[model samples]
Target: MRAVLLTMAALAALGLTGAVAVVALGLYNVSAVAGHLPGVSWVLHTTFRNSVWLRAPSEEEVPELDDAELIALGAGHYATACVPCHGAPGQEASATMQAMVPEPPQIEEAVAHWEANELFWIVENGIKMTGMPGWPAEGRDDEVWAVVAYLVSVQGEVAPELELQTGGSEPEEYCASCHGEVGGQVPRLDLLSAEYLEAQLQAYRSGKRPSGIMAQAVTSVPEERLSELATHFAETADEAGDAPVASAELVVKGEALAREGTRDVPTCLACHGEREDGRRKGPVLDGQRRGFLEVQLTLWRDGVYAYDPLMHAAARDLSNEDIEALAAYFARR
Candidate 1:
C-alpha cells in the first residue's frame, strides 16, 4: 500500500512540475500565428463534433424548415451576419476572414455533416475557440431556426443575393422581397402602429429582440429614415383579398378569447382594443397575419421580449390552441 501511495504521489508531483515549468518558462506557444499542431487540431475538432452531437436538441424540437418564407427570413439574416465570415453561394469570404486560424467553413459543405438540431445548437450557442458568435438575441430561438431553415434549403444550391437595398430611403422596395409587394405571407405592415413598428426596429438594432433578419434590415436603414419607413408602412392600406381565410369555428373561438379572455389570461382587448382615453399599451392586433400573431404570442410567452412584461404575463398561460384562436380572430379584422 505504501509503495502504491508513493508511486501516485510521484506521478502527481511530476504532472504539477511540468505544468509549472510550462507556465514559468513560457514553454507554450500562445501566438495565433503559430496555429494548433496537427494532434491538437484533431482533438479540438473531435471534441467540437461530439459536444455538438450530444448537446443538440432532438429532431422533434425543431420547427418545420421547408417553408419558403422561413427560409427567406433566414437568408436575409445570413446575408448580413454570416456572409462576412462564411461566404454564401457565389460569394467568397474576405481575405482577412479567410486568414482566420481554423477558418470558418463554407456553410454549404459544413451543413451536410450536421442535422437540423445540431445546426440550431451551433447557431444559438456558438462553438468556443472558434470565431463563431451565438445568436445575439438570447432567447430568440425562432430566429436561429430561421437561419437553420435557410441553411438546410440552400445547402447544395447557389445562394441567391439577399442584400438589402441601400442608396434610397424608400422601405417599400427593400421590404417587398420578403413581406411581398402587397403583404402576402408576412404580416400586413400597414395596419401596424408607427410607434410599434419603430419600437420593433429599434429592438432589433439594439439586440433587445433577437432577429437576424430584422437586425440586418434595421441596420440598412439610416437612423434618420427609421420613422419615415415606419410611417410609410403604417399608413398604407392592406390590399384587397390579402386576409387569410380561417375556419368559422376557429374565428369564433378567437373572437371570444380576444374579447372575453380566459380566467387566467387577460382580455386581448384590454390592451389592444380601443380605449376611451385613446391610450394604448399594446400594438393593434387586428388585421395582422395569423402566422405573425401566433409567432409573436409564442415568443412573448417564452419570455423573449423583456421590454414588455405584460405581454409575457398575458401569454404565459396561453396554449397552442389559444394562440391559434387569437391569431385567427385578429387576422379576420
Candidate 2:
C-alpha cells in the first residue's frame, strides 16, 4: 500500500513539473495566428458550453421574448455593437473578426445552437478565453435581455418585422435608432428639456450613468454632437405612437403622491420641473412612458444611480407601490 502511494505521489509531482516547464520555457504557442494544440479546441468549446448551461437563468427567471418593442431595441443595439463581429443575416464577419484566435461566430448560425437562457448567460457574462466581452455596464441585465431577444428572434435571418436601421451616417439618426418609432419603455425624448437630455448623454459618456445600450450608442457620437442630438430630439416630436393608457384610479393615486410628499420624502413635483427648487434641475417627468419612469425610479430606489446622493437618498424610502403611482401620474400628463 505504501509503495503504491509513493508511486502516485511521484507521478503527480512529475505532472506538475511538466506543466511548469511548459510555461517557464514558453513552449506553448500564444499567437492568434497559431493553431490551438490537439484536443485544446474541444476542451475549450466543451467547457464554454457547460459553463453557460450551468449558469443560465431558469425558465421562471427569463422574461417573455415576444414583445415587438423588446426585439426592436435589441436589434438596434445589435446593429451598433454586434454586426461588425457577429454578422447579421446577409453580412459575413469581417476579415479582422475572422482573424481572432477562436473567431466570433455569426449570430445567425450560432444563436440557433443555444437556448434563450444560455444566450443570456453568454451575452451578460461573456466567455473566458474568446475575445467576446461581457456586457459593458454592470447590474444592467435588462440590457442583456434585450440582446438575447434579438438573437432568438433573428434565428439565422433578418425579418422585415424588425424595423431596425443597420447603419447611420449622422448622429441624430444613430440616436434615433434606439429612441425613435418603437416606444414602449424608452422615454419620450421630445418631452425632456434639452439641458436634461444633454446632461444624461454626458453622464452616459463619462460613465457616471451605466447602460450597456447607451454606452454603445454614445461611442460613435462625437462629444459636440451629443448636445446637437439632444436639442434636436427635444424639439422634435418622436414617432413613439400615441400616449400610453392608464386607469383613472392609478393616475389619481399617482398624482396625489406627486403633488403631496410623504413624511419620508419630498414631493415628486419638487424635482421634476414642477417647482423652482434646486432639485428642479432633474428631468421633466410629465408625458414620459410609465414603464420608463418606473424603471428609472426603481433604479434610483435600488441605489443604482448613486452618483447623485440627493436623488439616491430621496428615492431610497419609496415603496414599489409609491413608484408605480408616481410613474402612472407623470405618464398621464
The most accurate candidate by lDDT is 2
Q: Against the true structure, what is each candidate's TM-score?
A: 0.84, 0.89
Please state the error at residue 206 of candidate 1 in Å.
4.1
lDDT of 2 by residue, 28-131 (tens): 77988887988999999998888888889896888888776777778888887877778766676889878987888876777878888889989998777787
- Could you tell me the lDDT of residue 251 within candidate 1? 92
Residue 288, model 2: Cα distance from true site in angstroms: 0.9
Q: Write the per-residue lDDT of candidate 1 for residues 1-333, one digit (tens) a residue.
A: 999999999999999999999999999997877899769999999999999999999999988787666777678677667877787765566787677888888766668788889999999999898989877667777778888888888774744556644566366667655554323235777777898888877887888887666776778767778888788878876562344588999999988877876666678898898789987667877777877788888888887766777678888878999999999888886
Worst 10 residues of 1 by lDDT: 176-185
lDDT of 2: 0.80
